[model samples]
Target chain A: MEVTINNIRKEFERFPALNDVSLKIASGELIALLGPSGSGKTTLLRLIAGLDFPTGGQIFFGDEDASHHSVQERNVGFVFQHYALFRHMTVAENIGFGLKVRPSSSRPPKSEIRRRVSDLLDMVQLGGLEKRYPNQLSGGQRQRVALARAMAIEPRILLLDEPFGALDAKVRKELRRWLREFHDRTGHTTVFVTHDQEEALELADRVVVMSQGKIEQVGSADDVYDRPGSPFVFSFIGESSHLPVEVKEKTVFFQGQPIGISEAAAGGGELFFRPEDISLVEAQDALFGKVTACRRLAGTRIAEIDIANDGHAPYHVEVEVPLHAPVALGSEVRFRPTRWKVFENA
Target chain B: MSDKARTSNPAFRDPADEGFATKVALLLLSLAFLIFFLFLPLLSVFVEAFREGWGAYYEALAEPDAAAAIRLTLLVAAIAVPLNLVFGLCASWAIAKFEFKGKAFLITLIDLPFSISPVISGLVYVLLFGSGSLLGPLLKSWGIEILFAVPGIVLATVFVTFPFVARELIPLMQDQGSGDEEAALSLGASGWQTFRFVTLPNIKWGLLYGVLLCNARAMGEFGAVSVVSGRIRGLTNTMPLHVEILYNEYNMVAAFAVASLLALLALVTLALKTLLELRFGAGNAGGRH
Candidate 1:
């Protein structure tokens, strides 16, 4: 079902968690709320789930006003970061808990509950292990059981608060892929909160970038990654290095030397670009600098360059080349910016 | 190099070294203290209970007053423990799950009995129920004898043990936040159902531990029951009171016999505490969320 959060605001004592934020989530859309720690992403998700009430705002599920509804009335499935599985319950019992708890008018038959539980377990790929307890299962398996339990009641919207956040790195990657597939198969409107940029970029149909209790930008993965609306989005989404540049007339000068601008220099601003965007070139559009350090990474060698400019602090630049690339410390080289964006310093 | 000599190298020694001989010596000293202070007294009680073999046990069991005292103690426990359980659950739920003005004050009120002497608790009830107090006339008008009656004893026991279960449950419930309850609520469970299925199951062990503690204390209570119970033979007299009456009347054997029974109850209490720890230890339950 479509969900709308209108001017939602929450205050914890003196600090504001959500500052009059509004967002519309389309029906059956999988949206990711992406931000760093303390960005209020999880708070927004809790408000939608009705686990928490906004200090001042309204929430709507479709045409119905759900602002005053209790968590039970909201009918949204929430999977917590730690899974929060009942340690005392078996997998089958946990999956069937929602169905069993339904009121008499809405309760399913015993056979139906059993059938649905089995179906959900199979959907999450834990079919044969229905009798197992949470502690008996692996971290990834427990997360899957949590997902199945959330889906058992056929909630209109599914909410995941860092579902794979507690797993190891390899398992996290695997679960992210499986979660995306599950979302696709069910076509359930889902909102998952995460501070992991890679997860947001890889899995979400729409990424909502939040900063300081406000939506910085909301777009598709490519839209937010390639064309960030603000410097916060640019710096938060991917690894980027900053280069100081002074805009003189229509030309941008890097360290007092005139450097070619992609277009007209808009004025004095900070240049933001990814390390992968900058290339090590022998000449052309070159900003001369000295290599301060070099290190070998997993598949690439990274070199740190200090671009010396007069009257200004040395610009720190990182360049990633092939592992086989020949480079040494204190080596002089001419570097160029392949792709860059300018932002006014805040 | 020989294996022992090679292993003795300082570089190969443990970085987190603890002297083995010192640890062994400390452990032995602790065991000696436990035997001398705890097990020795318990052994003495057991030996004294069976001093004249099964004859003394049967003689003690056959006494009408002894049987009446045992029944009275059990009845008091039955009334006190369940009431304390309900009160403790509510008090702990309020203190742990909700925050309000004067919450700390309410917690201190719950712990008042634990800090104050048990004799003081019994005296407070006696003052409220005796002939000199305001309610005494009203109770007398209704033909209620609370000062030296079963109800008086039960009330005093309840007051003395009120904090046991709540004390056990508050930290557990507080540590296990309202996350699971919220999850169950979101899953379409009503408030009562959520409490019955989710909250109760999580705290059941802690509740049981508290109830056992309350029961043991109520059964063996001496100081509080002695003050309020007037020690009427086969009437208001409980086991502890009976023990005192038998001893004062120069019935040393019967007094020792009843004291030994109360000592047995104390032993069972220690055993129950140990089992409770093993069954529902810190690592086994609570703190899930």
Candidate 2:
């Protein structure tokens, strides 16, 4: 079912957790709400799941207003950051919980419930572990069981909050791929909240980036990654550094020097560029910098440069240098950003 | 102290531990205190109850007042334990699962009964229900006797035993958290269904443990029940009150016999509580995930 969140605002005691947030989720499309902590991404996911209600807003499920529906009436599946499986229940029981708890008129029969539980076990790749309790399973297995349990109800939309947030690094990476495959197979209109940019970008069909109780940008992974609509998205989604720059008449000037790359007059905005977007040159009269440190980072040769900003505070920028480049400490080098963005008053 | 020797014994102490002499003295002192206070008192209860012979012991217990007291105690516990059990579940659910202001104050209020003296607990009810207080004449005109009646006795028992169930459940539920409850809600389970299937099972042993304590306290309550019971013979007097009356009457065998019953109840409560602790405290139950 398509979900439309219109003008949603949530306030807690006097502080707003979400402000005028609106989103439209197409049917059967998996999307990720990605942001830092306290960014209202989780709150939005909870609102969509009906676990929480917005203070002022209208939520529609396929043109039907559902803002006041309780979780039981919403028919949405939610996976918590922690697995939150019933510790005393076996895997099969946990998966069949939703089916068994349905109203008697709609509930499946015993045999059907058992068969579906077995099928779900098989789907999560833990076929014979039905008798094992949640505590008996490994972290990844517990998470898969959690997903299986959520999917048992055949909800119209599945909402996961920090789905892989509690796993080890290696296990998190492995399950990221597994979750993508699972999402593709199940094809539920899924919205999962995550602070992990890689997980959001790699898995979701669309990534909605949020910050400070507002939606920073919403687009495809490549769109948000390459052409970030805001400065927060640029620095948050990818490795980028910023320098104070002045924009005048659609031209960018740093340290009173116009070194070429210019776009909109984002007006006294900050310039941001990825580490790999700058190249070192030896030109004496170009935008000059002093190499502070040249070192290997994650097996890549990177140089830290301090750009001389005329009369202002000297700011630093990190750029990937060639492994054999002679950009040693105190070396005077000229550099220019290959691609950059300047967001005004950010 | 080689590492092998230090680690081999399960009674391993740190290198900066108390000296050997202090450990020995402390161990011996505790053992002596247990022998005198715990072991001896328990041994004497059985010995005295059976001292005059089993026939006499049965005769003492078969006395009308003793028998009536026994029935009264059982009835009071039967009413109090289940009522407090339900209250405890609600309190634990509200206190543990939700956040609001004055939460600490509410919890402290729940703990109020545990701290106030039993005499004060009974007195508060008496002041309210007795002739001097607000509801006294209204209750008397309606012929609903509470003070110096069985109702008064039950109320006192309930007050004294009130905190047991909630006390046991609060920490356990707090530790278990609202994660599973929220999960159940998301799984389309109604609030009552979630409690019945999810929250209840997770806290079953803890609840049982709480009820055990509440039942024991309600049955064996002396101070509060004595205050409110009015010492009415064959009517409001519980088992402990009967023991006191028998002892005062110089009916030593009868008093000890009734006391033996309460002692046995305590023992049974301890046994059940130990069983629950062994099951839950041994970390065998699959705890929160």
Candidate 3:
């Protein structure tokens, strides 16, 4: 089902948790709400799941306004960060809980519930472990059981709050791949909350980046990464270096000297570029800085460059160079940003 | 020298280990304290009851007043425990699962029975329901007896034992959290269903631990029950009150016999508690998530 969030505002004791957040999720789309802790990504996911109500908003599951509806009425499958598997119950019992708890008139027969539970276990790849309690299973297995339990209801939408967050790195990667495949196969309109940028970028069809209760940007992974709409997104999504600079007409200047770039908006602003977007230039007037530190990462060297600004603190930026590049401590390297954007100071 | 001591003794202590004398002294001190304060009193109760022989013990327990006391105690516990259990479940659920105004005040009220002396708890009931008070005369006019009746006894017992179950459950339920209930709700379960299937099972062990404690206190309560029961023989006399009355009347064998029964109940409670702790680990009951 397509999920629509219209002007959602949530406050905890007058402290805004999510302010005027709005988004539309297409049917069968896997969207990720990505942000750091306290950024309201989890709050948004909870709001969509009907675990919480928005102070001011309308949420539509398909065409129905479900803002004030209880989670039971919404019929959304929510997976908590801790899995929240019923620890006292067997895997089969946990999966069958939702069906069994239904009113008798609409409840499925016992055999049918059992069959569905078995099928769900099989789908989650834990078919024969039905009798095992949650504590008996590994973290990844428990999370899969939690997912199977959520899916047993065949909910309108699947909402996960850091579903793989409790697992170790290797398990996290494996579950990320497994979740993507599972989403493809089931194709339930899924919205997941995550702080790991890599997980969101790799698994989500569309990523909604939020910070401090407001959405910074929403786009596909490439769009957000390559064309960030705000300074926050540009710095948050990936490795980027920024410098205080002035823009005159279309030319960008640092410390009153032109750096040969003439495509900037006319204003004083901060210039942002990826660490790898700059190249070594022998030009005397090229924007340059002194290398204060160097560190080897993977097969490349990242040099920390400190640029002196006029009557202000020195600006620090990182430049990625080949492992064998002649970069050293205190060495002045002349270079310019091949690709950069200037966001006027606000 | 330390190396030589280690070689000679073959028991060199690590830095974390306390000195031998200190360890032995502390162990001996705790053992002595337990023996003096706990074991000795328990042994004396059983020893005193059997002093005049098992025949005397059986005769004393079979006495009409003692039998009536036992029955009254059982009835009081039966009435008070279940009520407190229900109240405790609701109270802890509200305190732990939801945020609301006056929560801290409600918690303090629940703990009122625990902090105040049991005598004061009983006196509070007296002041409220005693014949001199406002409602007592009104209740009497309605042809109802409360101050010196079974109702008053039950009220005092319930008041005294109110916090047992909730106190046991609040911290435990708080630790377990409301995540499971939320998950159940998200999957189409109603509030009642969520509580019945998810929250209840999550706190079952803690609930049982609380109920066990509440039952023990309800059965053994003396000061609270005494203040309201009027000590009527064969009528309002509970086990603890009967023991005191027998002791005061110079019925030594009968008093100790009844006291022994109370001690037995206490022992049984302790055994069950240990069994539960062994079965479900200590301090929050049921294994930590």
RMSD of 3: 2.5
Misplaced by over 4 Å in model 3 are A310-312, B1-12, B282-289
TM-score of each: 0.90, 0.95, 0.96
If both were scored by DockQ, which would come out higher, candidate 1 or candidate 3? 3
Instruction: For candidate 1, write residues B85-130 as lDDT tens digits.
Output: 9999999999888879899999999999889888988899889988
How much lDDT does candidate 2 score? Answer: 0.89
Docking quality tier of model 3: medium
**Runs in model 1 lying further than 4 Å from the true structure:** A244-248, A254-257, A262-268, A279-288, A297-300, A308-313, A321-327, B1-40, B46-56, B59-64, B99-106, B127-145, B281-289
Query: What is candidate 2's lDDT per residue for A159-230, written digit by digit as tens?
Result: 999999999999999999998888888778999999999999999999999999999999999999999999
Specify the poorest-scoring 10-residue window by lDDT in model 3 chain B: B280-289
Give the DockQ (2 decimals) of all models: 0.45, 0.62, 0.61
Model 1, span A17-134: residue lDDT tens: 9998999999999999999889999999999999889999999999999999998888999998888787777889888999999988889999999999999988999889988878
Q: How close is candidate 1 to the true structure, as a TM-score?
A: 0.90
For candidate 3, list the clashing residue pairs, or say none: none
Candidates 2 and 3 compared: the better one by lDDT is 3
Best by TM-score: 3
Clash counts for the predictions, in order:
0, 0, 0
